[model samples]
Target chain A: MVKCGLEIHQQLATKKLFCECNSELSEEILYKFERVLRPTQSELGEIDRAALEESLKKRRFIYEVTPNSCLVEADEEPPHELNREALEIALKIALMLHAKIVDEIHVMRKIVIDGSNTSGFQRTALIAVDGYIDTFFGRVRIPTICLEEEAARKIEEKDGGVVYRLDRLGIPLVEISTSPDMKNGEQVKEVAERI
Target chain B: MDTLRSKHIYKVKILSPNMEVEPGDLVEVKTKKGTFRGILMPKHEFSDENIIVLKLDNGYNIGLIPEEIKCIKKGIRRKKKSLYKFEKKDLPQISIISTGGTIASYIDYKTGAVHPALTAEDLIFSAPEIEEEANIKAFVLFNILSEDMNPLYWIQLARKIKDELKESHGVVIPHGTDTMSYTSAALSFMFSKLSGPVILVGAQRSSDRPSSDAYMNLISAVRVAKSDLGEVAVVMHATTSDDHCFIHRGTRVRKMHTSRRDAFKSVNSQPLGEVRGNKVIFYEGYRKVEEDVELYDKLDEKVSLIYYYPGMSGELMTRMLEGMDGAIIMGTGLGHISNEMIPLLKDFIRDGGVVGMSSQCIHGRVNLNVYSTGRKLKKIGVIPLEDMLPEVAYVKLMWLLGNFERDEVIKLLPQNLRGEISARRMIIW
Candidate 1:
């Protein structure tokens, strides 16, 4: 049997994941600000050389913030305590996959390259693991369930006005990765819908 | 040997440098709670404080205060690994030029840690789909954000691309979108005429995410690179559907969205070609590659783009226009801005600043004579960029600054260079 796995990332509806920033679009404001991302040293005492290396490719973040879309995510203010609404929604998805939940939820960093994320990394966490979901064909084990921040939506990049809106950054993303057990593309797509 | 077995509460602070802490020392002071347990991590940062940090079996950090009464059970001290890997591969005679942005990254599967993985291998593995196209030899010339990108990187990238022209088939540039259009336009102007496709590709999604557009973009880039098309262009997705991709001339493309798959588009002009299935199709009207390639990597970074809006202060426009070699003003409403903003525009022009006007509507041509404000702007030495995108104007302005004086720039802004300014505005009836 052909074995395959899947990692599906779905964006949430909120403007910002854990912050109260309005998620909207405005080009005039995007051109006014700037951001630089630095990688923190790993616990191993040695600098996270990879982070440093990536930071070198310093990608300037120019966000298009509309009055309706402007929010904590756009402001780049410290995140508020994790959004309970996002967390609960994530937990519900985890439960649907019949995964084991952890008692205390903590956030972790997932490095990103696109300019969509201002922090250079999206905050994510594993809420569930070792779960299984049933498909019409058979039962597939779920390896991990994570919640993450979505990247900014890309505005058209032409003249007159070059719009680079960031109304979508910080939108919660529900991610689920499956074990490499699928045999074909159909199975993969099927599991994606189920997850 | 098991001094860690003792229940003595040794308050130890995590320090990076000159601070002293023995291997088996029991250090504990206080915790946010009553108390906690564990031994010290080998090396620490100087900023660490009273809360002794401990490492648990699962590889996590916890800080405890001295008052927590936490007893420190010092454990066996294991020597830490060097935490470094230095490797250099004999990359194929390929060249990597950076305008801005990291192309690849590696995430540690063990500890949920993420870091930039920027090796040729990382580029290959991140987009395994490339192996099907050209045999790539890659190198990273620089890593900077697209916004901070200036004429320096543009010149540097062009030089690098020229260096690889002899040994490699084509070049692949992983760049950021914020200023990618500007760089692409600069390259288009520098290589005014090229022999092979120099494809600049970037992704809205980071490579680490499963839904990242990195693979597709890279594959399409490689396809463009390996194609017979001899030109400078930006290859990006054609639509959000992911079914088709488009090749935009470096001078004509722009980033239209903040975060969509179909963010890149050819402004006011048709795309050079489209990529479907495994095929790269060139629609009519693309220049063919020649045997000899001429390279020009010169750029002037002091150029600025100003937007003319209602209530806009001429001071702001003047500040941007003053001392600036050239400027592209994104005028509002059919190439018209407030008449109040014209003096600075005139002053900027009179002061040797090359001023080009583009419509803010993005889809239409700039009609400088359509309105009184537009007429005044034209009279004050503003060259209306027929259908040129603002991004195109920025790059063209930079290139013009490098090749010609301000007067030449004013003369050339309206002239069609590499299809930047459309001959006729394709208006739909």
Candidate 2:
């Protein structure tokens, strides 16, 4: 038997998930800074596999920022409260899919050090889980739904460093995951469209 | 014991007196937003009050407000120890001189701070692959940021290199990228002829980071040191990949980027050679080793470099000319300064001040005969430095002033000294 799973990421039309910055891309750059990220040991006293892999490449990260970028986007300031508008839209989608919302929202860090995000790790929170959507062929179970921040858009790579625009960073994004229930490619498409 | 030196001492006083905490200790903190668990980090020397710093388990650092803290609990402490062991083998001897940069450093797990690796053992511990290629002998001349490096240090460094060449095949200098090119140019002039290669290497990132270019750069430097190349050069990453490193002439290279593994580029000329795998490939017209080495360690540092820009006043130019032995003007286009400063420059030249002009374009030769502004400036006695970089011209002027008379300096500023000026420009990408 063949098992398939789908993970979909969609951007939210609202303010950034972790800051008060506007969710828009800016063409003018105001400032730039460089940083070197290092991998840290986890709670289990072992480093995450992906974080360890990224730490090995040892490339310097350059961030091109605009006025829209707050101290949060530059990693100089701590993140603010989560965006309520983004959370409301995420809840609306969860209700539409008949997914059960969690009692408490906890932000977790997923390590990603490819210079895409100013912060070495991306912040994500599980909003809902365990829901079912009906398709023409069968029912596809939604295993998880998460709200996260979008990474910075890479502008160019040169001189042994990667440059990223801070305008796209911190924008809210919704991630929806589904368990394998489709028997054919047509059914998978139907399931994706239904969501 | 590492003490927490933050201004949030009032908050620490509020916490239970029974619990003792220090920087780098594992601790759990409870705040109004949530509970945070990680290693307690020392406060930044200039950080504001009412906030605590923590290095989270996921390797991300976060700042917590003191007002939201409910309680703090200390956790188990773990001490990390190095496990590197060196085995001596029969190989070419290479001397490494650590001059303080990311290339000679590793992150301290306890404080999350980077410290210079002083001894050969420390470098070998970080990059064990060096032991397989060469018999390493390391020394720490002085630990300072490259920006703080001066002509005195260059003289001392040249003398040290002369002494090290007696026992080693080559010498490697791990330097900070900010002023690596200036140091390279200074050394090229100081050492008239060398018995072996004197390679200067630097890293874009610290060695503790897995993606650091330190290992490959040091490897390439050692390899070049062991090769037949006999001139001073800067060995760094040629591309973003780990394939090879380009060996740029000491006086012809510049750090073109603020932060990048390949920040150093050969300006106005091609690289002297390239280090691929374990071998060095010399380009055409490369310098060869000679049996006898000559060293010139005198440099007059009373020279100034003025980078010309629009709307700049002549007062700044006048001040730079005051008590200056010589000056290098980085002019616009084909080496032309604004018309306003031309009269003051003429007076300065008449007062026995030696001045040379180089283009800020960083490429192409300076032709003072091209435009009217160039010709007018040339009449004022500003020597056009042909195809020489501004920093290199500055160093060359210092060397010339130290060793030659005022008239001789004017004559020597335009001549090619230690390959600072190319005979013919080559178009190579």
Candidate 3:
């Protein structure tokens, strides 16, 4: 039996997930800064394999900041409270999926050292769990719905370093993950569209 | 209260129980909102008296209102000071003259603030691998930030290098990247002849961070210093990787980007050479001269660099030209300025003021004969500085005015001195 699953990341049209800056891409850059990222041990006393792999490359990350980018997007200032609109959208998606909404939101740092996320990790918070979407073939189990900050958009990659625009960074992103319950690709597409 | 002093009076009253706790002390502040734990940071000068500042473990500083703070509990006391020691080896001697910048600094864990690692010992301890390459002698010339650097400091720094060269094979200056190119250009002109390399190095990130460029930059600089190179150059990251570094001529290099590790670029020319691993690969056609070194340390501080823009008034130009020995105009597109300023410029030049015109485009040569406005500028006695960077032109004009007469400066501003201008353009990346 063929089992299919889907993980969709959708950008929300609102302010950043953790700052008041607008969630819009900018082409006019004012300045830029460079950073080097290193992997840290996780709570399980082990480093994330993917983070370690990226760190092994030892590449420098250059962030091109525009006037639209705030201090938080540039990683110069601390993040403020989570975007309420983004959280509400995640809640609406959870309700549509027939999922149980979490009472308290706890933000987590997922190790991602690929020079994409300025903070070396993506801030993700689980909003809902255990929902199901029915399709023609069968029912697909929705494992989790998450709200997270998007990584900076890659502008150019060269031998010495990679340049990323901070305008896309910190933008609110909604992630929906489904279990491998769909019997075939057609069913998976149906469930994905339905969700 | 004794430690709190005259600031944050309202917070001081609330923090009476924890009066013994100093700024660097790790503390847990109990508030109605939550229990916040971090280092008790010194109050900012403009901070309100109603708030207490704390540096969180995540390296972020946050302010808490005194009224919201229920209680304060002090934690471990931070260490006051730590010393560094270095061992002299039998390797080639290199003098490290430290000027204030992130390259020669580390973050104080307690305060979460960057402080200069002022001694040679501190720098050596931070990058222990350098001890094997060179017998290092360090000197802390001044501790001011690179933004405060002036012509006088350049004179003093050049004199220090002249003195340090007597005892070492090369001199490595750890400087702030902000004004490093200027200092490097000044040094390039000050030393007429060089017996060894004088390298300026800086880090884009402080040593406290895991990604700091301090170690690699310092290593590359030391490698370049120990090589056969005998000129002033800025050694920095050639690429984003830690593989190698480029040696840029002091007079030709400029800080093109504010924050990139490879911010320093050799404009209108290729790098003098690239330092990879333990090898120095010099680019083709680079000059190799052997002569007794001469120092020209005098620089006239009256020279001004004006970057001309649209709609700029002649009064501003006249004000800047008044009493100035010389001025370098970074004119728009092929050395053209507003027509209104031509008469003012002519009056300034006719009154014995030396004026040189360089392009603000940064990559091309300035030609006053190409445009009508430019021709007008030339007719008004503006000397076109071909292919010279505006900053370099400014520094060169200052040096020329200090050492020579006005007539000599007019002749020398466009002359190819010390490889500041390339005779022909080469398009090798």
TM-score against truth, every candidate: 0.62, 0.70, 0.70
What digit string (tens of lDDT, one per residue) describes model 3 on residues B41-143? 7665455665677655644455665433323555443333232334465688888888878787744444534457655555554566676788877767877
Predicted complexes: DockQ each: 0.04, 0.08, 0.09
Top model number, DockQ: 3
Instruction: Compute the DockQ of candidate 1.
Output: 0.04
lDDT tens readout by residue for model 2, A1-195: 656668888898798999888999899899887655545332213445565446555657778888779777876455788899999999888888888765455565665778787666688877776777888877889967888899998999888688889999999999888888777787888877777
The weakest ten consecutive residues by lDDT in model 1 chain B span B1-10
CAPRI-style docking class of model 1 based on DockQ: incorrect
Q: After superposition, how far is residue B93 of candidate 1 from its true place, in Å?
A: 7.2
Minimal lDDT window, size 10, model 2 chain A = A38-47
**What would the per-residue lDDT of candidate 2 be over residues B288-371, giving only the tens digit for each residue?**
777867997889989999999999899988998899878999999889889999998999889888889999899989999989
**Candidate 2: where are CA atoms >4 Å away?**
A1-195, B1-20, B30-36, B44-48, B56-60, B66-87, B110-122, B427-429
Q: For model 2, what is the alpha-carbon lDDT of residue A134?
A: 86
Q: Please report, as a residue range, the 10-residue window in candidate 1 chain A with the lowest summed lDDT.
A: A36-45
In model 2, the fraction of reference contacts reproduced equals 0.01
The candidate with the higher DockQ, 1 or 2, is 2
Q: How far off is residue A140 in model 3, in Å?
A: 29
